[model samples]
Target: MTGARITVDYDAKALDAALSQAVAALDNPIDLMDAIGAVIEEAIDRRFDTASDASGSAWAASLRARQGERGGKTLTDTGRLRASISRAVSGSDVAVGTNVEYAAIHHFGGEIERPARTQVLAFNDAGRFQSRKDSRARRDGVQPIAIATIGATTITMPARPFLEIDTVAEADIADVVQDFLRKSLNT
Candidate 1:
């Protein structure tokens, strides 16, 4: 992938104009999602366009065509959006890490300390069942166990063996974009 950076100076007037346009476009949540998706799609197009010597407008048109081929469905429910964006941006699946741990318990044979640490790998985007794998424990007492992998975006951690495991209930696309922006800016 090309790692070229493009720096365009935005003066106060230009910034104000852009902000005014954005405010004017603000409507509902879905509209916001669509706008954000457009921005993301444009950014991806720009990177490729520069390397290929294609105009920005032409690149955007190509992206729109690609989006249409995929049914022009840019935004969906939070879960679906996560999967879609991950696939679109990375061209690969993305996974979120969830931690699972166990504690000391009283069993039939006196106090029993079960395997102390277990981490459950959960898919960040999908609701369907995926394949699972075992991960190496991060610590001496903690056992790293990952179950169910689905496209690297979603998974389920079985309740068995571990005393407690936390799962992601939702994904925030805005936060994801902010994080991406932060990382991109720093680099």
Candidate 2:
């Protein structure tokens, strides 16, 4: 007699019950976002504190200090403390700008063959430079970097791929983005 192939079956009902219980224990999106926001706020506060030489000063104290010493203060260039935190949260090479659009994920044929990655780009506005000593004359200069924006977009992925959820809505993401701006401007 020829050997026959044998297959073993697992109980689907048991697996479903376990998965349901696990999902139930997961945190809601709002709660997760709030937690993230709190952490970000704390980091911003810390950076703001370190950037300023004097404690208890206003948020913009650091910027004012830099301006007083030099012609104009640049948050991106001079605010090392703020930059470090921003980089830590958003990742290195993240920057501020306008009219910038970046892809968070891309899929082929409605499914991802590879892992998803987030990309960020920035565009800055034009500006005119003026020196405190020479007030009347204007010179061409680079524009200040603005906050980068990220919006919601769907990306397809193959079955069993890792799941990524950004529970916060786009509006909320925009709000968090403003935190970086606030820190930069204040300092």
Candidate 3:
């Protein structure tokens, strides 16, 4: 013999058992994905209600609010953006978003540039630029005043991010996943 040879064989039955159970449990994760989606949606809705982001930081006030116009919550004027939010689950994947055209602008914040062909652009002025006298007039139920502006103007919109899951929401998701796994493994 050239040398003493040693041979050893290892059995992976235990590993296979554990893996097979997990694979079978997660074979179809549509329900799990839906549950996760719901958790995320709830967090987003809460953000809208609290006027805060996923990190629990308050969002910047809206232009209207800064202009001394009392109204409903920011980003909920008509509730279109919030109401348009929805979730779609496919297989093991889930997505949440809104189809509103202005959703991105509000979420990301950007500048809107309006160009005027003429030198001066005249339009009706409402609560935006009313003087104290004008305010008195308005308080007396007078009609809105007219105002003029020169050249192109850029309007900057601040970002009010609301499309994310917070730490609490993450904990909720973990609970959901654990519950799913526990139920799956039990069955």
Candidate 4:
């Protein structure tokens, strides 16, 4: 839980007023925060499943997808990052997201530059070397280079925002507030 997190902070002044009034009427307002946290958690999970952002726009195709890799969803390699998302409710606030080290890079999009520690770096090219130089290699079938060496690199990741309450989620949260207010009045 040391990395980035999505804190539940409403920007709508009207919603803030409504939430304040509604919670003031309740004896235990933390329960309402807990409910809101659950809603956010569900929304984030949905975004992962649909490969969509908080705005409901589809996430940019991952590098693996562009390379013709199959059998896994974007941001879901091994499911560690997705499954790491959780909610923490404290007082009248809730924060939802993951402690994964790479969460911010994938969510916000950025460049990572790795300086060569040694004189050279080595690794298999996995047909990439041939694909770049020879179209024939692509048509015939790429031959995996046993070893390739390079120094330093920059990896760019595109933003795939998944940690905000969108319009739909805002409406849902408003409904939750209204319901809690109604219940408080009833009690």
Best of the candidates, lDDT: 3
The residue-by-residue lDDT of candidate 1 on 15-132, one tens digit each, is 6765665444432234335434454444333333242212222111223334675543222112232233221222222232112112111001123333434335433234432323
lDDT of 3 at 2: 79
* Candidate 2 residue pairs that clash: 59-186, 60-186, 63-187
Q: For each candidate, what TM-score against the reference?
A: 0.17, 0.23, 0.72, 0.68
Runs off by more than 4 Å, candidate 2: 1-15, 25-27, 52-63, 66-187
Candidate 3 minimal-lDDT segment of 10 residues: 117-126
Superposing all C-alpha atoms, what RMSD in Å does each candidate have to the true structure?
22.7, 21.7, 7.4, 14.6
Clashes of each: 10, 3, 0, 0
Task: Tell me, by TM-score, which candidate is best.
Answer: 3
The global C-alpha lDDT for each of the candidates, from Candidate 1 onward, is 0.33, 0.36, 0.80, 0.76
Worst 10 residues of 1 by lDDT: 100-109
lDDT of 3 by residue, 102-145 (tens): 99988999998989633222223453543335455566555445
> Candidate 2's C-alpha lDDT?
0.36
lDDT of 4 by residue, 131-176 (tens): 3333444465564333334579898888998776677778889999
User: Model 3 — TM-score against the truth?
Assistant: 0.72
By TM-score, the better pick of 2 and 4 is 4
Ten-residue stretch with the least lDDT total in model 2: 100-109
